[model samples]
Target: MTGRPPKRQRIEPRFHDGESGSLDMRLTAEDRPAAGQRPNAPRKAKPANRQNASSGSRSGPARRKSAKSRRGKGGRKRRGGNSRLLRFVKRGAYWSAVLGIWGIVVVAGVLGYYAAHLPPTSEWAVPKRPPNIRIVSASGHLIANRGDTGGEAVRLEQLPHYLPEAVMAIEDRRFRSHFGIDPIGLARAVFVNASSGRLVQGGSTLTQQLAKNLFLEPDRTFSRKMQEVVLSLWLEQKFSKDEILEMYLNRVYLGAGAYGVDAAARRYFGKSARLVTLNEAAILAGLLKAPSRYAPTNNPKLSEERAQTVLLAMHDAGYIDDDQVKVALAETATIVANRQTSSENYVADWVMELLPGYVGSIDTDVIVDTTIDLDLQHAAERSLRTALASEGGKLAVSQGAVVTLDGSGAVKALIGGANYARSQYNRAIHARRQPGSAFKPFVYLAAVEQGLTPETIRVDEPVRIGNWAPQNYTRKYRGPVTLTEALSLSLNTVAARLAQEVGPARVIDTAQRLGISSPLQKNASIALGTSEVTPLEIAAAFVPFSNGGYGVVPHVIRSIRTMKGKLLYSRKGDGPGRVIDPYSLGAMNRMMAETLSTGTGRAAELEGRPAAGKTGTSQDFRDGWFIGYTGQLTTAVWIGNDDNSPTKRATGGSLPARIWKDVMVAGHDGLPVSALPGIYEAPVQVAEPAGSGLVPPGRIGDDPGRPILPEPGKGRGPLNLLQRIFGG
Candidate 1:
């Protein structure tokens, strides 16, 4: 026991039966009379029986002899009474010895239990583990539990009176009015054991049960019983009756994968503990003994029978009236297991996988306030489903992910995969597919940095950068095209020449500054998205252009709060150093705006908002991509089969663009209209390329915050420091 008392005596013995002999046949000092009185000064005559008649006849025949014998008989009779008393005393001594040993064992066991488990007053026996429950949202009304991230917690004083009464009736009738131990009930249990010829029966009170559940060993044993009594007494002394009752209700197991009454309440009735009816409470109470076998979720018939037993107990305990019993008997428990069916199924696995990454570990009751806008998440899902339906062919897809962020780099909505269950291959955060033509903007940014404007001339005709012949998507070159037209039309040949002109090294440097972590090859085809990249990398890379050419990293967790509601840590938005000149960033935005306005993304034109976006259709259409953003929000969409096979007739504009538009429309429903945070001016006046039809350039914005140029040897700093430590 954690803190229970030793042992208790049920019945106090009154007297000892230790006498020597029969009263009539023994002599005693009392029969000799007092010192001043005569030794046999005539004993008081007693009412005589049949034996007395014979005495009278014998006295007459031998009057003298009889008188003498009678004189001696009084003393003998007195001694006889003393002897009988002595014998009774001896027998009483034997009984006392047996009772003493029994009492000592009981008391010793109780004391040992009390000493061992006396300190802990709470539910110390439960496994010390991180809670697995993840509530999607916050409940406004209740104080949350320790495991409750956003859910409710019920307190002791708030318990409905009927809840405890039902529990008391179902678990242990004599809960109160005991000093943490119930001797009478134990005796009765002993009788029951004797009748059944087994010791499975017990008389552990509710307090004892609570004590056992909270702190002591679970093994059914006399020693455990002693410990339970000790712990129960200690708990009773420490906590109030109501508090103990509440703990019992909230901590008791109720089967169906539910722990406390609150979880059970939600699982069965699709509601909170406060709303459960008396009948519902009774049904739950019935599950106290053998929760699995009697659970309403598993066996309704047996559960009803058990509930009736609880009701009858309650009626006997005078807790309910006749009508209530009748009604309870007639009612059936309608328990729907896991009321939130399929809700947790879709997000649980993804959320769990991310839990550790967000907090650097997942073994705490850390509250993760995600930027997931449930509304946009729903819309993204709906639009994708609609597009899939239009295809009329089931896509051989294992997973899908979407990441939508506001213009300020705040992730608005995200779904890691369609079902985070079948496989937790979070494509939104993990998969690295080639960006195809989607990477052209970085090439444009590189060109602008090297004194090249959007209208800078480049040939879209067949071009050979070394051995690779970069051609247009149609394989037929468009001859000469301005940079603006090339970007909009996604002409591959023009982009390849621009990268070659900027020198492959500078282009690679620019991609790195834009927060693309994957290695980029120093080849001409790099402009055509030959390198692999994740969607998150693309979103994060675009954040710089969105935020006036300042690099910003993407992060999900804002702050971590402990299970006890203490703040542990937070993620501040400090990323890798600034990249891209504001002037170049603005020029790229202008070109992308044109791309959306009248080019490949002409399908993306909204009602009145000015938007900029790009479309990417890789070779064989293995991956379809659309990276788009308004002045307010930025969203990127990619759709393809996971097997890297062609999505039949699917283009970035076909389905991905539509999904992107739908997601952005829902995600940007609120907020103000602000200009994109970039330079107001354009590049310094430059000669327009032939057939470009470009607008005249304004003065260039301040040439500050250029992409951090890679050091001569990829920084011999931290990487070198670790290398030195290991001498590797």
Candidate 2:
């Protein structure tokens, strides 16, 4: 067969370009050459394909499928990531909800635990404040306040506007808006403390502080804090903002034993809260943070600085404008000088001790009219403090006490110590120390009551009783001295001999009769003033000598009355009358007068006035004393170490006498000077020739000068004879 196959015939369908599109002129499969054969030759059968093929092998659809597969993979990958993220978020939310629920439960349980310890809601109420004791001086000037609340509670309306404003400004500016607890303040405090790495700010609102002060213990534990919070909420719910502020002002404890704004105002400024100025109010408010640290009486400069801070806070809080702040800064609060350490409080304390005895239990505020003269009290305090401050170190004397009284036994001024703030031991009224030679008056009085005169003679030589021998302070004996001279010079030997002969029991009786309540030892040493007694008692005992033999009980509270003016107590009369007879009184007064005029107490002599006092120095100079009195006033001054250590030769003739003189001078200012009772000119003694065997008309001398006579049962010897003559 020929290789060439059939010839191809071309047929074209003619159509105009405009009429119809050109038809296809290519060869059709039916008219074309057969496959697997030469061109135009006959067709052959197809062999079986080895390669596997399916619908997936189609290129057109496979390309499309591959692209679709790639797109699907990317979509699946994105969906898987989204699914993981969604699961993570769901788990986190679920755990967060669980934790949140547990946290709320724990907080609720903690709050419940603290709240359970509290009183029943219906029973919650402000506790009644302790009754106040307002002590006023004899001249009706406020001396001090004595009570749980140092001063009376003042109403909010009574206080100056700036006082509460200053407190609110510095303590809690959001006081009006906040609901008991201040979350914003707490958060701010936390942030500040955390950032500073220390506690510089407190989150306590005013309500919180009041709550803590009123109901909660002053502890810094978390439990206490929670309790404070609960109480604060309760307080806010129970009272209005103004009421809470008022309670805070009236209950918050300031320093120096003062509680409440009224007390603080009076304590620091010596004025009522109603009268406090802006600067003073700021100072009072400044004390809230640390009362002692910023107390005006303690550190005035620091207190002023703190007050300045308060002023600034007030200015910032819009309570005071810039002009007002400037004015306040310029007019820094003038703190009452020495208010905390004032000797007036000593008198107030003494009155308080006697309050219950007079008025029974103190359930209501009482006004105690004290015999204290504020001016004289200040004078005494200044004198004692000045002496101690200037010479205490040099003399090795740390403390001193002074007590002044009128002849009627009214305590005009009393200082218990050099600084009452440093020590509250009322040395004037409580401390029983050896009066030393100050007790000699009682001995002499006893001898006088037994018919001895001031002119009676006694030898100032060493005397012994048992094993105890009393020696003079100078350790020198002055022989053949009169009773007046012996008492004036405070000769220990003469006193000892007299007490031995007449019996110390007589001396005890004399002392007790003259208002000395302290127990006395019945011994010869007691004549040398070895017995212990309070300054108050010693001064009281000496009152009879100044007031013409009328005994006095040293009293500070002149009268006591409630705030409503109901009289509870009033000192009725002068005293237990005539404890000392005229004979003994005249003799003792003359002898003690010679002491101030010519003896050791000459330093305490009051000019142009007849004053009598005795000088006393305890053994080793541990205590120095000057107990003296004018016709109008009697004062006792004692200087010593509280620990009973010896001083640096501090004698009664020195610091104690100086303090006594200063106090007496101040006490007698503007008063008529009069001679002491029973003080008169001594008749001039005609000089007796030396070695004369005859005794002078009124003199009882040693042997040969006087006859050696004895009483019945007593031996007829010089010693017994002399004892009879001198001891009587």
Candidate 3:
């Protein structure tokens, strides 16, 4: 028995038969009849045995309960899983919101703290740059740019388009598109710094960099960074975009102590901003990154590599074409090796030192028109450095100086030392060293004024005064030597004798009158240059001999004027009048000329050009000097040590003479050769002192084949100065 096959019936919504002819009805799934069964058909089933029926009914109830239990368990498992997923999502969202709010609060606090330290933006104004001195050579060559800026401020429009473009490409690619601070760059920097765990990159926009340079200190703190941001925003609001860029290019530090693009160009490439080429522009643009580290002047090879990177960046930025990039990469850029310590600065310093005296005080930018021949100045520096490099080690010479002056006493060139950077002590004008035999000319001039001819024979034997006995450099003496010969050979005893006869006072007077401004000791030892004097002093003193007995003040700056050409100080023809008399001038020139021709200064001779000079070696070679003069130029060169140590048997005739020759040859390149003033030869018979004491007065030796002295015994009447000094 199928247990009545579970009674199946069909139920449909029924309407009353009298209501309508058609019945509206719908059959539902629960009301539908079972498969293969008619409505109410289940009532026909009958049970056979009571036990089997009971068993079948019991089994059906059990299976239904088990299925219900399984359904309940599956439903509870699904509900639990849904609850866990919902809790996880809700917790994650809660924490994410809390962290985001916390991050906002922290950023706001930091920004506020830095903002409090910044000054009010309303009170901001661009500070004025320090005044700069533009120094130019006598021939209008820019010798150097002086003062803090190191060069004149150049306008943005004055620069090459590629120059600013190059800087923008490398320093800030989105400079124009962004506001004062570049959000994109800052975000990128944040990401990079976060990954690196350090502040390795500063994503400063061009406007931000200008703000820092103009108004903020270079501290790498967040406070400084915030201040820079504030200032950059202010700058953007206060000025136009191009104006901001102008100020930026004019204020950026481009290494080598150069404050701006113009200064960097002048300081490094030795040019103006407008003249910067593609390669040079690339190199200068590269300097914005760790300026000194990548400075072309300091590290050329490394700078080239950096420049290549800049060129690639510029090309990538579309500021330059591929061909331009190739050209810049292939070409080389020249840079000034040292701008601060350059020899040109030495000259500029010297000129500046005198500026205060000439114009009282420099409170504004001024143009100094100097007499410095930049070419000759370079030659002087080269000669000094070359000499030091080649021989300074062996000769124990640590320093040297060179000063060249024109016939009118204008300083042509002046080098203070071997390396201006190593030592700024201007040895040329500040070092007071004994001139040794270079001083003999003054003593000889005194003797000649007192009427002793250059041809007068003097004993070269050892001479003593008090406890001092001056000996020859060779420690050997010729029995009889003419006064001319003695001065030529730098004979110490003869110089001492001449100094004694003329009296030390007369020698000092003569020297002071000529141009020796240094104090001279009034002792007999003055004959051998015991008095300390500067190379400039000695060089100026020799000017009288070259310029026909006229004194010189040794001026450097010819005129100082404003940039608009307003004269501040113009040097007039001012100097001490003629110091040496005509007769003595002729005699002195003859003797000194002999020294250059065949004596100690023979090494300093100019080819076919009449030259006269003196060689000076202080006692034990403490100083070596060669002060020589052409018809046009007079130069003095000194080589020694700062401590006054003796040289390695180095004499004035060795290094100083060679340097003088090298300098003068270049100095007289285009000048016509001329004869030395008052140089002449005279024929005379000297009555031997041992045979008859009668002598020819006013007759010096034959030098340059001229008669340099007046007629004998015809000394302006009866027993003039010459007749009295030497018996006629």
Candidate 3 C-alpha error for residue 246, in Å: 1.8
Residue 593 displacement in candidate 1 (angstroms): 3.1
How far residue 266's Cα lies from its native spot in candidate 3, in Å, is: 3.4
> Which lDDT tens digits does candidate 1 get at residues 1-728?
59879688664433323322112322323344664787668875544532354544432224445545756767668889999999999999999999999998888776776567555545444333335334342222111122432224466556567777998886777776666677888898889999999976678777777777777768977667767776777778877776677667766777766667776776677777777778888888988888889878778888888888889999999999999899877776566644333222334444555566655654544555444556666687676656656652654333445777754455655655554434446677778888888888888877766555565567767777678987777777777666788898898888888888777787777777777888788888889998888887787787776666667676544555664777756667566545656656776777887777778887766656667788887777788788887666777787776788776656676667777777777766775555655534533333333443322122223343322221122332444423322235
Deviation in angstroms for 198 in model 3? 3.5
lDDT value, residue 246 of candidate 1 = 69
Writing each residue's lDDT as its tens digit, candidate 3 over 126-159 gives 9877767888899998888888878777778888
**lDDT per residue, candidate 2, 80-163, as tens digits?**
999999999999999999999999899779988999988888999888778898888888988878889889877898888999
Task: Give per-model TM-scores.
Answer: 0.67, 0.71, 0.77
Residue 515 local lDDT, model 3: 88
RMSD score of candidate 2 (Å): 15.9
**Which 10-residue window of candidate 3 scores lowest in summed lDDT?**
698-707
| lDDT-better candidate, 1 vs 2 | 2
TM-score of 3: 0.77
lDDT of 1 at 433: 86
Q: Rate the local accuracy (lDDT) of all candidates.
A: 0.67, 0.81, 0.81
- Where does model 3 exceed 4 Å of error? 1-123, 297-302, 339-342, 360-365, 388-394, 479-481, 680-728
